[model samples]
Target: MRISLSTLGCPDWDLDTICTTAADNGFDGVDFRGYREEIDVTQHPQFTDRLVETMARLADAGLTVSGLSTSIRICFADKREENLAEARRYIPLAHELGVDTIRVFGVGDAEEHSLEELARVGGETVRDILALDGAADLRWLVETHDNWTSSADCRLLLDELPDDNTGILWDVGHTTRLGGESPAETLDAIGDRIEYVHVKDAVYAPDDENAKDDGWVFVLPGEGELPIDDALRELDDRGYDGWVVHEHEKRWQPYVADPEVAYPAFAEWYRTVLE
Candidate 1:
């Protein structure tokens, strides 16, 4: 039940400020966004060095690393090869940083590919990345995003991969938005394959015709209309202890002004509700 914040919410800030703010706010860890403007491919070659420094900085600030969110698509056709090659470059870096997982997104949309094809492509991509073994370090984590956000869909993809080192990184908000599935059902579908969890809240209006595209919006854990309490209760009942990354995605959803300001509020909410 350790709580963390993804730097995705604060893509405009530097790593130093991010670590400092996270530690100051009583957060346990920071999920670094590896492909933002402030944090991008230029440092890809020096990843080992950069990650070592990042680790030290967080340690000095009394913070841990929840994970790394690499903005690389693993399931897309045109970008899959280049993305895998790029991911191969970060495996050693992640290991050196003592990061256990790297977050990746699946490709295709509900409109583009059949569920069967998406599952096959997602599984194949995961198998390939898991085989990299760069420095025999790091595990690949497929996130509940885009096409694979459904609990049943992700379960299908997970069935195709080796469950030992590869698994699901469940994003609650995204799952609810895209899949329109209940938290209990989603958890039941993924079962033990959930290696990580992205915690956020959203409001859904199923009655609206634009509901699928525009109903959801980011908010603090307990602030939004989402059933976070029920979700957390289910997670607790199941003995789930994965990282709860407070992923208020300000990059795409800018309702929250700044992560520096928002993370502390969310941390307080987590402490009050989850503690």
Candidate 2:
């Protein structure tokens, strides 16, 4: 399996810093969630007019562009145009960077609409995007997040989609801690469709008011309570050779361990797993 660093881990780092740091830390690739202060990297210059320069920088460091995480909400029918517009902008960028996988959000709130309704709308919206020219060349993985953390609930959306080209970004932390799924159980439901993965770990701090999923706080990989090794084992046994990205999420939680600390920590943990 290939290991990569999500730029979510280092929100403040520029392209050069990202490439050098990732190569130094033993990462195979860098997944662009954003660059520097810009969260929507499609609009960023590194991905636009200067894309060739960016690609050369990554290649010089023996890195690939693993994935791109976008804020496009696939399940929200109300923002259909916004979602399609986002797709139009990034589809070409994806092709130029040789990044075949991208992350989108299928995060539908149960309060806003029924699962069936969300799935129906999401299916239509995603199909529309996929039908666009050059879109079929790339895979769009809807992140396992928000109200759609549970793989079973996620199936309602996944089933509506076509094939492997559209799937889930199985965030182990959310599915296990928030969705209450064992790794085996999650694979049982959507293993075939898991084109990419986000590797995060957290401790169950049920009393900490600021913690997510009722106190499951994000921590450096292998340091917190989540089943880092078991999850990797399950993926290996199932023949998942896709990118397993260390999503440190410093963009959202600025107080967490810095990428310099967290990225190598994840790499060291993966080495132990291989042993």
Q: State the displacement of the C-alpha of residue 100, model 1, in Å, after optimal TM-score superposition.
A: 1.2
Q: Model 2 over residues 47-146: C-alpha lDDT tens digits?
A: 8888889999999999999998899988788899999999998899889888889789986667989998998888998899998889999998888988
User: Which residue pairs in candidate 1 have backbone atoms (N, alpha carbon, C) closer than 3 angstroms, thus clashing?
Assistant: none
Among these predictions, the greatest lDDT belongs to 2
Poorly placed runs, candidate 1 (over 4 Å): 39-51, 109-112, 135-137, 204-212
Reference-based lDDT, residue 117, model 1? 77
Model 2 regions lying over 4 Å from their true place: none
Which residue pairs in candidate 2 have backbone atoms (N, alpha carbon, C) closer than 3 angstroms, thus clashing? Answer: none
Q: Tens digit of lDDT per residue, candidate 1, span 127-198?
A: 777667662356678898877888877877777766776788988777776678778988888867888888
Q: What is the C-alpha RMSD of each candidate to the true structure, in Å?
A: 3.1, 1.3
